[model samples]
Target: MSTKDVMIWRSNRAGTHYVADTVVMEEPLEIRIRFQDSDGKWVERPLSITMRTPGDDQALAVGFMFTEGMLLKNQLDKVTIGLENTVTVHFKPDVRPELEKLQRNFYATSSCGVCGKSSLDSLGYTYETLHLAENLSPLSPELIGSLPQKLTEYQSIFDETGGIHAAGLFDWEGNLILSAEDVGRHNAVDKIAGKALMQQSLPFNQHILMLSGRACFELLHKALALNIPVVVAVGAPSSLAIETAERFGQTLIGFARDGRFNVYSGIHRVDALVLPKK
Candidate 1:
């Protein structure tokens, strides 16, 4: 369901031909929350509507709530996937969410998640600083370089549509633990985080996050929310992304491809001995 076929006219130097083409699917998914209000009545409210590819909707909802600091794993009762592109998260009866504090207008596009924010202050969500063990083994540059190829093997949707973003989680040894894809880069990361949350795996402190596109501030912010210590991207990182990583002790690497990568922060996590010789 992640890809759809449509007829189009393809033109090349040889000639123009009518053919069926595949494209990544984009659709609106409404995320809702169900909890007991102060008056002891059950209340269900729309939280956010995001444009994303049509798989992993439940994880997206859970991840969104976790990153937004609205829902904790212990408070989650169950998730219900309804028709018409809607997902509802039911919380424990005692759990009351402070919906007023969330300044988002509840709409997010595939390109940007923060576009619906009502103020700049809401952008600064509290994040924990990462602290790696002194005895932890540093990741080698060769292992980092090999991640992109490994990630591609998991991107079944991208191979058909050629238009999707992916977020992959890898261990120190460079084995992919999980990966998710969506039209929005942030949603992809959210899906991965949501999956981990459902599996009772929070604080990805021992893993590396790999991005299929440029590392933006929002993506880094989500990574921080999940306590992922290292982030690698096939593209470049934004100025704010680098600042955030440097500020929070997370390692940020960009341009990771073809047996090379550039580490922007937390250089100590990457072994210096294996760096490509000039």
Candidate 2:
């Protein structure tokens, strides 16, 4: 149910005609958590309700929890897809989540994620510090430039609806390892992270995260949560995104199209030709 078909009137210079059109489906998904209380009682509560595309609901829930620091890799016991548009995550009995620490407003839109937060401090989460060794191999600019085309090839939902954002995981050589699409950019990235978590592939330090839209602070934060050292976006990046990348020692690239890209932070990771002094 990723897309829906409808009839619309298409206009052109010559004339107008009625035609069938496909649109990306947007729906609300209720992510709930079931955990054991200190008294050895089980509690189920609604965590968040986000608007996203219909598919990959489980991954979305897992990734969101991971990024928000509510669930760790080992804490996950199982995920059950409840009634329509609802997902319940059961954590291990020993894993008691600090629900009060979550400062989110409990509702999120498809476009922006952090907008639902209560304070700026809530934007920060505890993650492993990223350390790039001097001997680490640098990625070529050519490979970064080719990521958009590689990602586009696998974007079935985007091809059909033409209105979905995507996040793709790539190897050093620019080979797409996995990708996810949703109406919201953050949801897509969450799906990728969630799938990786399920597969026991935490800490994507050796991978590159590619985005189909402008880079934002939340996206960078999610990448940091997964320890992804490199992030490349097809569009421009916000000022906060640059500052975060600089502070975290992550490689950030934007405007990654037409076989060229601009490296904003961690230039050491890009093998760009040194310019001659004037």
Candidate number achieving the greatest lDDT relative to the actual structure:
2
Question: What are the per-residue Cα lDDT tens digits for candidate 2 across 1-278?
Answer: 99999999999997999999999999999999898989989989888899999998999999988987778899999899999999998999877887774435368899887665553356564334454333568988778888999999989999998999999999777888889999999999999989998889877888899999999988988888888889999999999899888877889999999998889999999888879899
**Residue 109 lDDT, candidate 1, scale 0-100:** 92
Q: What TM-score fits each model?
A: 0.93, 0.94
Best by TM-score: 2
lDDT string for model 1 (145-217, tens) is 9999999999999999899999899988899998999999999998998899889877678989999999988
Over 4 Å off, model 2: 102-105, 116-128, 131-134
Worst 10 residues of 2 by lDDT: 125-134
Against the true structure, candidate 2 reaches a TM-score of: 0.94
Candidate 1 is scored at a TM of 0.93
Computed on alpha carbons, the lDDT of every model, listed in order, comes to 0.86, 0.87
Instruction: Please list the Cα RMSD from the true structure of every candidate, rounded to 1 decimal place.
Output: 2.6, 1.9
What is the C-alpha RMSD, rounded to one decimal, of candidate 2?
1.9
Whole-model alpha-carbon lDDT for candidate 1: 0.86
Residue-level error in angstroms, candidate 2, position 80: 0.8
